[model samples]
Structures are given as structure tokens and as C-alpha cells.
Target: MPVDLETLYPKLVNLLLDPVFVVDESGNIVFVSDACESLLGYTASEMIGTLIFDYLHPDDRERTRAEANRVMTGHPHTNFENRYLHKDGHAVHILWSARWSEDDKLRIGLARNVTSLRRANQTRDALYRISEAAHGADSLRGICDGVRQVIAELFPRNDLHLAFYDPVRTVLTVPDWSVDRANDWVEGSMQPGTALAEVISLGQTLLASRDPSQPGLGVITESGLKSPGPLNWLGVPLISNDSVLGALVIESQSEHIRYCAADQELLQFVATQVAIVVERKRAEDHLRFLAHHDPLTGLTNRSLFYDRLETALKSAGRHNSLVALLYLDLNDFKQINDTLGHEAGDQLLIETARRLEQCTRETDTVARMGGDEFTVLLTDISDLAAVDAAVGKIREVMAVPMMQEGQIVLISFSVGVALYPQDGRTARHLLGSADSKMYEHKRRRQAG
Candidate 1:
């Protein structure tokens, strides 16, 4: 009634959860257990006589060879690890226990599929690194780059794209490193119907593959590289405090690589961390900007303008050049405010700031000193004539009619010009001279 030992041994090995392999000195797979079909998606008959090295992950081949040599030298390895490509083309992490059989002139090994365990460890490490990247990076772009790097490690042959939305300002911002961006893409508040836009607006994760039968994202190929097979694209919304702040999109760069539900979950976990850091950094940046900028007109404030004026004066002194300061006041600004209401008055001021910028060179400094008052520092001026010409350009631009509250209104401004060293050397002195000239011009307009 007892079974033969030879037949019973093979049956016991076949019933094992882990796959057993018998390889010759030439590294050919001479025999494999039935369980190998579950591990590598290959039947024993198909794998027999094939070179085991051909199935190894390219990056892990050299180290695996070294470990094989160690095992062949009678040093049996119980916990050796390597990666192999499954039949589906995704990498499968394997833990091996093997020994060289001298009598059989072959290497006998057992293979355990450790892919899930390895992925868990990798995900844990990746989350920690992403947290570091988010908080440690100096800017939003740096944070995005760091997140991309970490993701590339976890999911090989993939790229990450970041797009952030500010609900308060209604601006959509993508890092400069985004892949395959459209030619007309701009940073602003408007919503687009693109894939990434849908992810953000709908606050949902999207898993798309290239499907020839359907109209949506038929093929997920990036612009530069064409994958030989279908590429998977996964986008996860970055949610902060129940509001969608941005999206993190990952696309496969290789052939036949598809992202599954697990991949989406992992990316979402990391995205949560990214959203926290990005929001914190943006707030910090806004505060920093407000410290040196006029919130209403988005122009440089008095404090920063004073600093720049002093710096310009010193530079002019060094080069023996002239620097001019133009003080501007919106004539009858309060009268307009009283007549049209403060809302119309604010609109006029904002429009005035825009016109001032349009009339100046990029090198010139335009600032909002206070309500109805602005200053411009014109550096490296050749002579008084240059200053006069700049003032003329400003006056001409400001004279254009602006529609406020459905009413066409004509605006005017009075500018007082002061030259460094001529109007007095210091910032305070130059400012005083400009103020006096501005008041004198206002009085002259009144008398006329």
C-alpha cells in the first residue's frame, strides 16, 4: 500500500507552495516544480532548458551571479534575494535558498515570491523619503522633483507630473518639469477638460490605459518616447482638509506595464503627504510676498521700494551716473471715490498701476507707496531729458479713458521728478524734494 519513494518525493515537492528548481552547471533550468506556474507564470515544460539568467531583472543580474557563485562553492544561501521578470513583464522579487549538488552535477534551489513583502517595505521607505522631500525642499518645484525621484524608484520606467491649484486665488500651477504639456498651457485659474484637469476638478483618482476600442486616452504614450505596448497612466488627487489642492500623475514609460488598484492606493498615500507640505510652503511664500508687496495692486510696497532706491543711489554714485525718482499722485482721486463709490475708485487705482508698469522698462522700479500715491526709480538715466521723456510716456498712457462701473472715466496724474545728488543725496532728502515738487505741480494745476 506504500507509495514508491522516487514518485512520492516529486509529488511532495510539487505540492509545496514555493517552487523548486533544478539547474545544471551551465545555468539551464533542467527541472521546475508545478508551483513555478503560480510564481513566474511559466509552466515547468516551458521553462525547462531555458537559461535562468535570461529571466533575471537586468539591474539585479550581476549581484545575483555573485550570489550564485557563492552558493555553487558549497556556501548554501538561505536568504538570497533577486528579481525576475514575470511572464506579464512586471518585476517579481524572489527570495532563494539553494545549494550545489556535487553528485547530481546541478544546483538545486527553492524560489519564494517575495514581491508583496518587498513592495510593502519599499512603500514604507518611499513614504518616509517623500515626507523628507516635502518638508526639506526649499521650494515647491524642489518638493515636486523629490517626489518624482522617489516614485521613479518604486515604479521603474515611470514619470511623475505635478499640478497644484489654489482655490483662494483660483490659479492652477504646474511645476516647470511637467511632461508632455500642451503648447497653449498657461498658469491660471481656468479649468481645462484634460485628463489631469479632470482628476483635480473631480477630486478622484484615475487609472487609464491605452485602449484602441474606446475614445478616452486610447494610448498612454508620452511625447518623446513611444512604448512598444500599452502604457498605464494613474492620477491621484492631492487632498488637504477635504479640499482638492492638486494632482500627482504617474505614467508608465515602458511597454506592457499597467498600474493596478494597489498602485493607485500607494500613490494616494504619498500624495496626501505631498499636499500637506505644498500647502504649508505656499502659505509661507504668500506671507513672504505680502511683506514686500502691495496686496491690492500687486506692486512693490514702500519698505521694499526704499531699499531698492538706496541700492540704486549707491550704484549710480559708483558709476558716476544719474538716478531719477518720479513721485506720482492720482489727481482728484478722492473726488472720484466720493462720486463713484470706493469700489470704482479701487478699480481705477488698479488700472493705474497696470498702465504705470506698461510705460516703464523692466529695469525700472514701480511701487505703490500708499493710497493714490506711487513712486518710480529710473536708474542709469543719461540726463534730465530722459527723465522728462519717461514722464511724458506715463502721462500719455494714463490719459486713456477707462470704463468703471459702466461709466467711461478719464484719469490724470501729476508726477514730480527728482535727480539723485541734484535733489539731495540721501533717500529721505530725495523723497522730500520729490514730495515738494509734486505738491508744487498740484498747486500749479489748481491755479491754471
Candidate 2:
């Protein structure tokens, strides 16, 4: 039997995966294949009579129109790219191979949906930038700012929120850039059932909408969103080493916007990188704190104290002012440590450090030189009377009784004072003189 080529040709065109479009010189859709419905959510019958420009995304219309005009001028374009509005309203990226046919007075075009490919490229670029942010940023805030900028480029007109969980405090903290409901919502506990909370606690990506069937799982309605339409939210947990550290959330309230499955996947991937960076930065900060601080008392350590004392001596030399060093030995600290457990001894030491800090000015430096022994660097001393007054204040504050391990305990300091230039010139000489005087005072008390 002979075949009818005309009938078979339409069937063959419809069988192709990519949609074929035929628009007249006036830019009206004269013919479209059935495959377009799969790519655009619009049936061929509905699209045939509509203006082709009607489907072009508003942001891409100007460029797309220019391309169309060039094609109508007898130029064929194979690599032109633009965005078209899907029937459901999200953007559909289209790559075109098109030409103008003078005989038919029609513009023939083939469209390949490149939305997924374009998103993949964007994700790759975003990941590289985020990694740079992690390595180059000096602080947590800087890192977050960089990440927010990269994310904003990927999803424009969307609000981004980063909620971090403080495992020690059991609180969720949002950075300052967060907007409206997220700022308010993230302040408290990561309570169960909340959208963000669920993302972190369950270590899962969540897609929520105003649709009743997909209930936002306690999505905050009073988010103060100014847009007048259904709200949509996508949250992905930032997980590191199998632990849920926080959540990265993007929200939109525009009727035309929706958070789809691809968005959820991409965000989740990006959040993994974010969690690693944040965790690394926090660890670096903690290590830096430990290096300069006493672990037990949270005061400056011996090494930092010496550096400050040397700096103070140089400054006092230039200013012609006297600096004093006070070496303090806790009275019978060992006896207390023996009577009560080490934990109670630690509490006493922490309390003593606080009291010592309270007695010193902000300009002075307080340090723990190991084993209930501490040193204070006093700067800008006027004369001997000023030094005496500072010593008197320390004695008065230390005389108060403290409750430790359900027992009333009294603590005092057998303090030794060393004046700059008068006792010794250098930091080592000053420390040696102070230590000798402290032992002398302790021995006198024992004799008395």
C-alpha cells in the first residue's frame, strides 16, 4: 500500500522529543507540535493561535525579540538561548536552532529544554564561589555574606535565611541578614514541627507551600511577607559528618514562583559545603581562644601575660609613667583543694579569677601563672599611694566568704608588689622580685 507522506510527516514531527514551532512573520504561532505540552505544560491546540512573544519570559523578551528579528532578516541562528514562561509559571530555558523561510513566510524553529543543563552549570559556579568564600573570609559573618550573595544570584527575588544550631546552648540563631518571620522564628528553640526545625532535626530537605494538601508543617503564616499570594518555602539541612548543624532556607511568596524538586536537590548540595565551612571556621576560632587563655580560669595564660608586661614596660618608658606587677598567691589553696574535691577547687579558682578581674581596670592585664598563682599588670601608676590603694581594694574584695561544696570558706591573697625601675627594670626582674616578696609575706603570716 502506498503511504501518504503528508499524514506521516506530522506524526514523525510529533514523535520527536524536542518541540518544533512554526510562527508567521507577524510573530503569531501558526503551528506547534504536540511535544511542546511536555516541555511547556501547554497543549499544541491552545498555543497555535497565541502570539509567540506571549510565552517569552518578561526578563528575556527584549533579547528574544532581537533574535527573532534577525532570524526574519534571513539569518539562521543555531545557538540562541532564552527563557520562556512555562504554563505553570516557572521559567523554562530554551536553546534554539531557527531560520526564516521566505517561501512559506514562516519562521521555523526547534526548541530544546535546557533548564536542567543551565541549572547544573549555575550550581557548579556557585559551589566554586562558596568554596572561595570559605577559604578567603576572615570571619563567620563574612563567609555567610559571600554565600548569601552567591545564592541570591542563583535564585533572584528570593529571601535567604541561614539558621545555625548551637548544640551547646540548644538554640537556633539566625544571622542579621535574615528577613521578617525567619528572624523572629529562629530566635528560640528548634522546636519540633516547625518547618526549619524539621529540616535540621530530621536532616532532610523540605518543600512547603500554601497548598492545604502539602501543609507547610507549621509554616509561619505571619512571616510579614508583603507579596499578596500563596507562600512557598524550601529548606535544606546543613549536615556535616552525619550531624545536622543547621538549615539553609529560601522563601518566595509570588504566585508565579514555586520550589520544585530540582531546587531542593541543588540547595541540599550547596548546604553540605556551607556546613563544612562553618564548622571549620568555628573550630579555628576555638583553637585560637585556647592558645591565649587559661583553660581552668578563662584568664590570660602565662605566655600572653609576659608579652603584655613587656609591651607595658616599653610604653611606660616612653610616657615616663610607673608600671607595677602584683604577684598573688592564694592563702591555703591546697588545703581547700584537699578538703573539697577537685571540682570544688576548680569552682573556687574560677570565682577567684572573676574577683581579681573585677578589682583591675580594663587597661590592666590579669593572668593565671599556674596552680592558684596569678599576676596582674597595672599600668599608668601615678605614685606609691595609687599602688597601695589598688592593693587595698584587692584585699577587701578577697576577704568576703564564699560557699563551696556546702561549706563556708574564706580566701585571701598574700600579694607581693613590684614597681617598675624601682624594684627591677625588665619583666623577668619584676616577676622575680614579686615572687620573692610574696613568699616573704606568706612566711610573715605563718610566723605571726
Scored by TM-score, the top model is 1
lDDT of 2 at 175: 69
Evaluate model 1: give its lDDT. 0.84
How many clashes in candidate 1?
1
Cα deviation of 372 in candidate 2 (Å)? 0.8
The local distance difference test score of each candidate is 0.84, 0.86
lDDT by residue for model 1 over 63-161, one digit each (tens)?
Answer: 988988887889998999988877766678899999999889899999999988987997899878988887788877788779878888887767666
Error of 1 at 147 (Å): 2.1
**lDDT tens digits by residue: candidate 2, 1-448:** 9999999999999999999999998999999999999999999999998999988876678998998999999999999999887876677889999999999999999999999999999889988999999888998888988999988988777778788887888898776753453443335576665677777778888765543333223363335564223436788889888888888988764556666677777788789889989999989988988999999999999999999999999998898899999999999999999999899999999999999999999999999999999999999999999999999999999899999999999998798999998998899999999999999999999898
Residue-pair clashes per candidate, as listed? Answer: 1, 0
Error of 1 at 98 (Å): 2.4
